[model samples]
Target: MVTRRLVLSAGVALATAQLSAAKVFFREHFNDEGWRERWTVPTKWKSESELGEWGWTVGKWHGGDESNKGIQTSQDSRFYGIIAPLDEPFTQDGDLVVQFSVKLEKALDCGGAYIKLLGGEVDMDSFGGDMPYQVMFGPDICGSGNARTHVIFHYAPKNENLLAKTDVRVERDRLTHVYTLHVKADATYEVYIDQTSVRAGRLEDDFAFLPPRQIPDPNVTKPEDWVDERRIRDPAAVKPDGWDDVPKTIPDADAEKPAEWDDAEDGEWEPAQIPNPDYQGPWRAPMIDNPDYKGEWEQPMIDNPDFKEDPLLYRRCDGCTHVGFELWQVTSGTIFDDIIVTDSLPEAFALAEEGWARWKDKEKAMWEEVSKKEKPEMPSFGDEGDDDLDEDMAAAMDEDWTKEEL
Candidate 1:
């Protein structure tokens, strides 16, 4: 009875374990095109303001200058400012994902993109000023001449300030690649570059927060409110530190130089274009989708098997290979694949490597292709499955089965 009870308990435990292991949740893709239509752009936010805020335009794609063909906005700045209402206020508990598509005519300096979440008051200038949130793809700076472009992921909280930046470069000249970000409220936040899991971590606790300021009184102007007179020590007197007391130097005799001085007869001095450092490609947010929940689905890699094998050959023939290359990530016993392609690999790699070197003085990994070889297949389970059973029966027969049958 005791042995039977123990066996029953063990069986029940094993059944429960199987049931738990079977439950799995695959990520959903969220679309930016659909999301943009659902959100509104705030007032006082001009489409193209004097402060160079034109990059904050809304809509699917707003074509820009000829030089930046296929770009939604100017290459000089980051594009799109999306303001949407959440059904429930964002907290540190729920999961959220944001994705989009971007292309570069050619990479530019300080040119990169990111998605910032704001829970409290959001100041666009500060990129989520006082919000308790994270940025999936944070801002990045492109190296001089690299044209590598791909999706990048930045895990929030942990990547607070400038340290939180990770990017995956895609093949050059590809358009409309998909990218995804997975953010769970309490658990680890993950960023998939293309579809590759590039980063995962907890939210950092040391976010900088400023004290709230009181609204200025409209009826009476305070000293600080009056811009011109606020700093006046006396109404009729100017302090030594005031602008009037400061020495203003006039141009000397030789100050009036030629507008095009020291030219080589052609024009102003043109610095030689420096090759882009490795891994300095511009980062883009790819597309996301969230259709009805399906059982543990996997996103297939947009195949470019001959990417490195025939770089120039495929770059001209296949646009997909030209635009980006795929990436792979292993998480929770599952593998996720993504792609990164830019207009230029040699350029983007140089830029990414340069940026990495600036932050940390480490040498970038040299690109190499491992030789592939074929191997013989091993026997399947069916071929060997009956061996153990046959051996056991032979032993039993030798010991007593023959005598019993006789």
Candidate 2:
């Protein structure tokens, strides 16, 4: 019989091995005071506010997060961006997952709360709108395409850069929700919002992965002699003999000539015209299926030469050393937290639960509280401050201060 100590030792060893095998390439909760050490903010980053500032702070408390602090945008009309280098690069293989939480405290009229994964050779100091990224993923709200989560992968062909089309429109609200993108090695991708799967499909089918699988045969054309008509007029159908005999216009029975009519001066009198009841519209032969009836013709399909299979379509980025936020906000107050990139989906979800799930309810309650709170009454000009002046001066300046009365 096996000893209990051996079984206990094996269990501990298995657990340790599993932990070591787990690939958590990068993770940030924005909790540490030394967060600046991990993240870098560009010097040229700008805000459209009066101060023209970028308000990016860690350990920021807005009374909506479970933690005492999180990364938040403190002002309106700003472009806030910060980047952190990964410890290791992600190659184009295996599984890849990106997860994060976003809380829109302001009614975002226009904004992009998305993150970019940059390649190893990116210019950290000059990271801006013009900088190219390997992947851009997150929620973007603007105009009619509001609350759409983008999962765009960049592909460079010759001198042009194109993005894959994958947009999953999400519900717009001012509450924290977790957004996750899980891409498997089999070219399949799944998007999860609030731990619920919103989209899932093969990358090759969903995106413009390759040139179309089939194309219309170039040599074949619709021939002029093709008799493809399915219907024809019935030759047996004939019009009635009285068809045209019915007069289109007839004399009105109820109408009488004018009482004081002058025949010579007004020309020969004619009865007022009325619609003839027997009159019918034009007639044509009835239709019937043609004896040579043929079904609708379709252009024959041929194998596309440009179509090529990509087995590593869902693979991770190679030499992707940095991840960052590069976005524009018309009205700010968007908080980002619990950003993680890993090979395991469970780890990403667990990280989201720690921050987003724990505080979303309380954050929603806080929003409701502020919305329902009564506005404080404005102070009257005739109130306490007027007492400092003389009685006559106070009376002259005060008395409701209505412009019409003045």
Highest lDDT model number = 2
Task: Report the lDDT tens digits of candidate 2 across residue range 132-219.
Answer: 7877888887644345888887654322233436569665566677889898888888999999999998877777656788999998
For candidate 1, the TM-score is: 0.30
lDDT for each residue of candidate 1 in 1-406, tens digit (9 for 90 to 100):
9999999999988766644543112111122334334344343343344112223222222122222211133322323333443343333223444433333222223334443333444443332213334233432333323323322322332343333333334322212223444544454355444345656654332112111123333444434422332122233443333434333333243334466667767676444434333323333333334233243433333433322221121111111100110111110011011111222222222322333223221111111110012122322224545653343323322232121211
Clashes of 1: 49
After best superposition, candidate 1 residue 379: deviation in angstroms?
Answer: 62
